[model samples]
Target chain A: MNLSWMAWTQPTAIFFIVIFCLLITMSIWEKISPGGGPRVGILRFETTRGDRLFLSLLGSAFIHLAWLLFAGSNLWWAMGVSILYAGFVFSFV
Target chain B: MNNKPFDNKAWFFVLPVFILVAISAVIPLMTVVNYSVQDSFGNNQFFWAGTEWFTEVLNSDRFRDSLVRNLTFSAIILCIEIPLGIAVALAMPRKGIWVSVCLVLMALPLLIPWNVVGTIWLIFGRADIGLLGFTLAKMGIVFNYGQSWLQAWIIIILMDVWHWTSLVVLLCYSGLVAIPEAYYQAARIDGASRWKVFRYIQLPKMQRVLLIAILLRFMDSFMIYTEPFVLTGGGPGNTTTFLSIDLVKTAIGQFDLGPAAAMSLIYFLIVLLLSWVFYTVMTNYGMDAPEKREVES
Candidate 1:
C-alpha cells in the first residue's frame, strides 16, 4: 500500500480533478433532466443520452490516438476530428 | 432495429458532422497525398517527385518489417483480450452494490492518458524502485524491459491488456445485463447446462458488443504508439518498432516527409482494408444465425 513513489504532478492532479468535476456535472445533469430512455440509433441498437456521451468520449479518445499515431502530435487535426465526432454523437446517436 | 419514417430533413442534422470530419480527415489526408507525391526542402518550395517516395517506401525492408510487427501485435492482442475479457465479465456479479465498485475500478485504467500509463508502468517495472520489478527481481528473475526485446514486448502487451480489457468487460457487461430474464428462465426450464446456456443465449446476445469491442481493440492496437514509445522508445534494438513508431521516426525524427507521407497512406489503407474484412466476415457470420436474426426482428 506504499505510495511514496507516486508523484502527484500538476497535470496528473488536474486530470483527476477534471474527471471528478465531470462526474459531478453529469450526475447533477442526470438528476435535473431525469430521462435517458433508450432511443434507436444507426448502430442497430437503442442507446440513451448517457450511452451517446460515453460513445462520443470513447470515439474522441480514439480519434486523438489515431491522429497521434498517423500524423504528428500537433493535435489540431485531432481536435477537429473530436469536434466532429461529438457533433455526430449528438445529432445521430 | 427501428422503423422510423424516412425524412430528407435528417440530412441537415448530419451536415455538421460531415463538415467536421471532412475538414479534419479529408483535408489533412489530402495534404498527406500531396506530400507523398511532391518533394519539399524548405521555404515552402516544392517539386513533383512522381511517386518516387512511394516506390522507395514500398521496397524498403524496414517498412515491411514494421508492418509485420504491427499486424502480429494486433492479432496476438485480439486473440488474448477477447476471450479473457468475456471470461472476466461472466465471472462478475450480475447484481449487487459491488457492481458499481467493480466497474469503476475496471474503468479507472482506461481513463488514464496513454503516456501516463506508459510512465506508470515504466516506473512500476524498474528493479530498483518499482514494486513489480522489485518483486520479480527478488524471485531471481532478470526482467529488464529496457535491455531485452522480449521483455519490452511482454510489458507492452501486459500494459495494453490491463488498460483495454476493462472496455471489453464494460461492453460485455452492458450486453449481458440487457438480456431478457425470459431467456434464462427458459434455459432453466429446459434443464440447459451452463455451457449450453452460454453458447445459445449469452453469446448471441453479446454479439453486437463483441463486434464493437473487437473493432475498437483492433484499430487501437494497430495504431499503438504513445505507450510503447514512452516505455521502450522502440527498444534496445529495433525490436518493438511497430508501423506507427517507424512512421513517426521517419516523419518527425528524420524529417523525411515524402517517404513518411507515402508510408502513412499505405498504413491507412492496410488498416481500412483489414477492418473491412473483419466487419464483413463477422456480420456475415451473424447473418448466418437465423435464430439470432429472428430474435432481433
Candidate 2:
C-alpha cells in the first residue's frame, strides 16, 4: 500500500480535471449568454475601467483588513464587521 | 423572477460584499488549488505531483464514504426543513408587535457563530447533565450520542434543523408577506378554502424563495463542520464523519495536503454542480408557470 502510486496520485489528477471542466463551462456559459448571469455585485466594483476596478479592490481589501484589526482574532466578528461595513458602503455610496 | 429591471448602480452597492466573499472564498480556494498539485515534505518544499493526488482521492474509500454521508445528510435536511419552514411561516402572524418579536427570536440562532452553535449543542446533548439527554433517559429512551451512531446522527440532524429551520421560515415568511392582499381578497370572494388559497396562491409565490432556501441549506449542510465536530468529534468511529470533517482531519490533522486539497476541490465541485442544478430547475419551472407566461406576454 505504501509503494502504490494510486494512493495520492489518482485523486490529484481528478481534482484538477474537475477544476478545468468548471472553468471551461463557466467560459462557455459567459460566451453563450453574455449578461444573462448574475454579476459580482458587491465584490465587483461597478466600473469597467481599470483604475476604478483597482481602487475598489484595494479599498475593499483595506476595509477587510481594518475590520480584522478592530474585531480581534474571531473570524465571525471579522465577518460581521466586514458585512456591516459593506452595508454601510452600499448605503452611503 | 421579479423582472423589476434594477439599475446597474446597484452593482456598485454590492461591490463590497463580492470583495469580502472573494477574500474568504476565492483566496482560500486558490491556496487549496495550489496545494492540490504539489507534493510537500513539511518545510515549504514542493514538487509537481501532477494528477496523482486527484486520482488517489477519487479512488479512496474514505472520500467516497464521506461524499455519500454528506449527500445523504443534505437530502435529509432539505426534505425536513422546506415543508416544516413553510408550515411555520404560515402559522406566523401577518401583523402585530408579536411578529417583530418572533422574527427577532427566530433570527437569534442564525446570528450565533457556527462554533458557538456547536458548543451549545455539545453541552445540550451531553448524556449526563444536558436537558435533552436527561429527559430522554428519564423517559427510558437511553439516548447517548457519544456511544451510539444512530443517536449521534439523530441529535446532529435535530440540532441543525433547530438552528437553521428559522432561516427557511424567515425566507418563506418574506415570500409570504410579499404576496399582495388583493390575491387573498379575491380568493376569499371566490370562497376558496384556506388550503386551496395556500396551495394556489401562497405556494406558487414561495417557489423562488424556497429554491433559494433549499440551495442555501443544502450547501451549508454539505459543508457543515463545526457543530457536529464539536458535538460528536466524528466519534464512535467514522460513522458520523461527514466530508468536511474527513477533509479537515486529512488536511490539518494528518497533514496529508495533497489528499485534503483534492478532497476540498471535489467537495467544492459537488456543491457548485448541485447549486447549478437547483438554479436551473427553479428558473425553468418559473419560466414555465402559466401566470408568469401571461405576465411576460
How well does model 1 score by local distance difference test?
0.81
CA error at residue B3 for candidate 2, angstroms: 26
Top candidate on DockQ is 2
Q: Where does candidate 1 stray beyond 4 Å? A: A1-93, B1-23, B275-297
For model 2, residues B1-297, the per-residue Cα lDDT tens digits are 445565669789999998999789865776677787777878666677755676678768888888898889999989999999999999999999989998998899999998898888887876688888778888888887888999888988998999999999999998888787888899999999999998999998888778788888988998899989988889779988999899989988999897788778777766655665565565555435546524633
Per-prediction TM-score to the true structure, in the order listed: 0.68, 0.68
Worst 10 residues of 2 chain B by lDDT: B288-297
Looking at model 1, what is the TM-score of chain A? 0.77
**Could you tell me how far off, in angstroms, the CA of residue A48 lies in candidate 1 after the best superposition?**
30
Relative to the real complex, the DockQ score for model 1 comes to 0.02
Clashes per candidate (backbone, < 3 Å): 0, 26
Off by over 4 Å in 2: A1-93, B1-31, B275-297
DockQ of all models, two decimals each: 0.02, 0.03
